[model samples]
Target: MTLNRRAFIGTGVAAAAALRAPMVWSQGRPRVVVVGGGAGGATVARYLAKDSQGQIDVTLVEPTRHYYTCFFSNLYIGGFRDIASIGHSYGKLAAEYGINVVHDWAVGVDRDAKTVTLAGGAVLPYDRLVLSPGIDFVDGSVPGWDVTVQNKMPHAYKAGSQSELLKAQIEAMPQGGRFAMVAPPNPYRCPPGPYERISMVAHLLTQVNPTAKILLVDPKDKYSKQALFEEGWAKHYPGMVERIGPDFGGDKVEVRADAMEVVIDGTVEKVDVCNVIPGQKAGRICEMAGITDGNWAPVTGYTMQSRIDGTIYVLGDATAQGDMPKSGYSANSQAKVAAMAIRGELLGSSVFPAKFSNTCWSLIAPEDGVKVGAAYEPTDEKIASVSSFVSQTGEDAALRKQTYEESLGWYAGITSDMFG
Candidate 1:
């Protein structure tokens, strides 16, 4: 209920005889195949099955049994949360909702045949396809970095073992050592993620290696919650964090994973630990579906349907929806709208106007939280923002603590919404 402005579940019984004849349920019943089990795919799968009762068949195709959310992995890295706390399982979505959850990889999509090919060679026929496979890194965006070298300079972007790897590496750093972070380019998932990671790293270093220094090699001049983060850094841990922007060779950077060196402005420096978050694109499944326009899938603002293929809807970080940041909350919101539209098409359910809302909260230090959010609706061309709000600079302790507490509640609520 707390996220009701962004999520809605509709139910109504109207005789198909009174409405459009084409919308009547077929005898065999329509089948919906959802690829990926992140916020978007999971929420839509649950809603479509639960709201429709037994009117349709829902199958969720996801490779992972337990999903670790990328949203709060930074907090886990910071030691505020344990790894088990952020992990969720798909058992509830299967048993409780009567969904056919398939633990397999969706290798190919046959658009003409309306079927999906799984890794196990089973073919699933679907009336509607929902793809929300999340993000994949652009090849060679970080010089001298690839999947082969991820263990050395882990991105820790995907959560789980990578996050634990990064945490152990950071803790193993020597006293007064240098830790470097090569931030990603614009239009990446979780705009505030890297900065939050920095805050968490700082929080850990302040207690362990008080003399350690953190150097951020950032392409962007400014980051989300810039003023507030800077204020907290200066107040809590001064002289420990430094940012090198593009103007000072932040954009011109490279890494040598084998040698553990970072090249900034043609100057190579040895580092104790390196975190290279590469530029991202839509997940590989999107490309396989032949719906991606460049690195992302272009979608209509009103409904998350692919502009290239109307029968297939794309959601979350994989979509190129205007103005909406590729966050878990945004994906969940988009899934509801797409679910409503899909239900209306197959089950003759009533459709409502599409609306979405999102909020991204970050912790600078313990009990010190900051946020930015907006409510949006479809425009002629994009998902335009109607209104926005952000945490003010130099806020009192009480409000910041309250915000952090609210974020904890949200994390609990959202994971339940997605998994259960």
Candidate 2:
């Protein structure tokens, strides 16, 4: 089937009907409740609705009416794109795909009862549950950093208001104002996100305020694209962006929100703007459900079914997929595999091994983009390495433009795959 954007977005109701009609005509359809409307949940819901053909009832529970993607949020920060461009409405999933999308927060999951409870007191019973609620902050990681403090020093990781807050701060700052970014530790969502954000912000500063400086405080010594990012920063915004790694005393910095100061090795550094991305763990719902031991839920790789509760499948940033960073691309890919597995299981068919792929793009400049990608196959007990690729360094204008084009294509393809 050739799926275009309009057709894809418009098929939500049809997809839902296919799933519903089969069940109504035959024995009962298996109910699948997806908690989250982000990359993982959205993809699974759309695919299940489209492919299940009334054999499965898919209901996606997400609190947001519109989703703002972190994938290209940096473009908004760079003034290259508007926030609306990155925003997506769920109307397609509701009207065309026939997928029931509930705009409410899921409070708890009653695994024994196979029920998901919303904060508004709605109880949704399901034969299978898909949890992809994403990550929450890890408390105590940064001194004096919490939900209250986040308002003052926004992370902007979740996008929306936080993104606007940071952009406003950048715009209001003096020509030489210090813009500090505190990146989180590893195993967090979107590994390349922080670096890309810094690049885009720096790109903006170069045009608006030549003397503006960016201080990157990273806990780890290495990052997603260390060499490439550094090269871009130095070549484009020379002496404007300074990155401090763990080896250079970056990990010792302490954040104080009330005073709006960061202390590095007992030296206080005042900044006009602060973007602090804290350590992350599984979403609160996972904790409330008692499915997670620490920050993430353990899941069977083959089925994405929770180790603690077999009936519940966890995807996206909520589940611990060993070695896989919590990324939107990863979440979307995992969701498809999980959806297929669930379909087979519900149909009393043997589950087959799954393969997954991810391609993450980073825009360094308005026209210059870089990317890293990987394709994987399952091995005994875990998904093993397969193949990976990264954009070659240097000023290849053609390749740079190609990367940008590919990035947009990916957005279209993935969105269509999910909503169509």
Candidate 3:
């Protein structure tokens, strides 16, 4: 099926029954405690609550009152959008959908008790647990860089304050100062994110500090939309960006936050600003729950259910599902499938065959956007891609502008779908 906004909405509806009846619960209403109010968790919570029609008790646990989406964060950095524009609140989810919105951190998960312990010392019990904790950086992933030193060399991967920090640092750069980025390896959240960031940074620098230079040290030999970004950078901001791949010691790199220097191979280059996007793993809570395999949580694509524990489901950037990139769109799509499966198991609702889709849009420059996406289905082994599409090179200006506008519409639509 072609998965668009309307098609996505259709996935959230359950097949009609001639005589609808609420399932009887032994211990009050069936409880679903969703940790992380993101694309996955929020969408799942909303769908479960809305589709179940008051049969399932849904609670969302998120520490922050306002969620800043990482998807459009690059635009914020590039001055295309304000921070408030990307920030969403759970008010509608609570007021309209009757969801229990708890602003607290989920500190621990007890698999045996099927309970989640919050940092504020409250324990939440649940018949079903949904984990969509986006991502956390791997410790020592980049030498001399950690959360303590993030103020010196910001990652800005989580959006919000970090994005503000990076943008401010860029704007404050000397006319001809150098800015550097230590891009993450494969299997990172938003495969095209770091590159899009480069494009956005270039866009920012060209207007304010035209002479400034960007040094991108990437471990990967190739990146998402490589040709498109390269073409845009060349066409829009020529002589402003340089890239170092693994052949030139990009893989073997380190950062010195105090000195504001990047050590590529044996060479140390001082930079005005450094954005260090380190290797990533599933949110720490998955490990705490003993549901993670190595750096990620493994789940069945059919229901987004944990391979380790069926009672739990993992979504979004946290899952080790195959084929699908770790993206907000991917998580939102998966949430609907998981929500349907959970409802079916709990309320005997009709569950359709799981269909997943994701499209990643990157703004190359002003009105220059490129995208790649695919439709997916659950096989016995994994979520396999059946078909795909991408923005091609040499596209006319009109089409590129249209792609950028399409992304804006998608951002508005998906955030509404997730929060409302």
TM-score of each: 0.95, 0.92, 0.97
lDDT of each residue in 220-241, candidate 3, tens digit only = 9999999999999999999999
Q: What overall lDDT, based on C-alpha atoms, would model 1 receive against the true structure?
A: 0.88
Off by over 4 Å in 3: 1-22
Per-residue CA lDDT of candidate 2, range 144-237, in tens?
Answer: 6887877789989898888888898898889799999989997788899999999989988988888989999999979998888888888788
Better of 1 and 2 by lDDT: 1
Candidate 1: stretches off by over 4 Å: 1-27
Q: Which stretches of candidate 2 lie over 4 Å from their true place?
A: 1-27, 349-352
Write down the RMSD of all candidates, one decimal each: 3.1, 3.9, 1.9
Cα lDDT for residue 191, candidate 2: 91
Rank the models by TM-score, top first: 3, 1, 2
lDDT of 2 at 397: 82
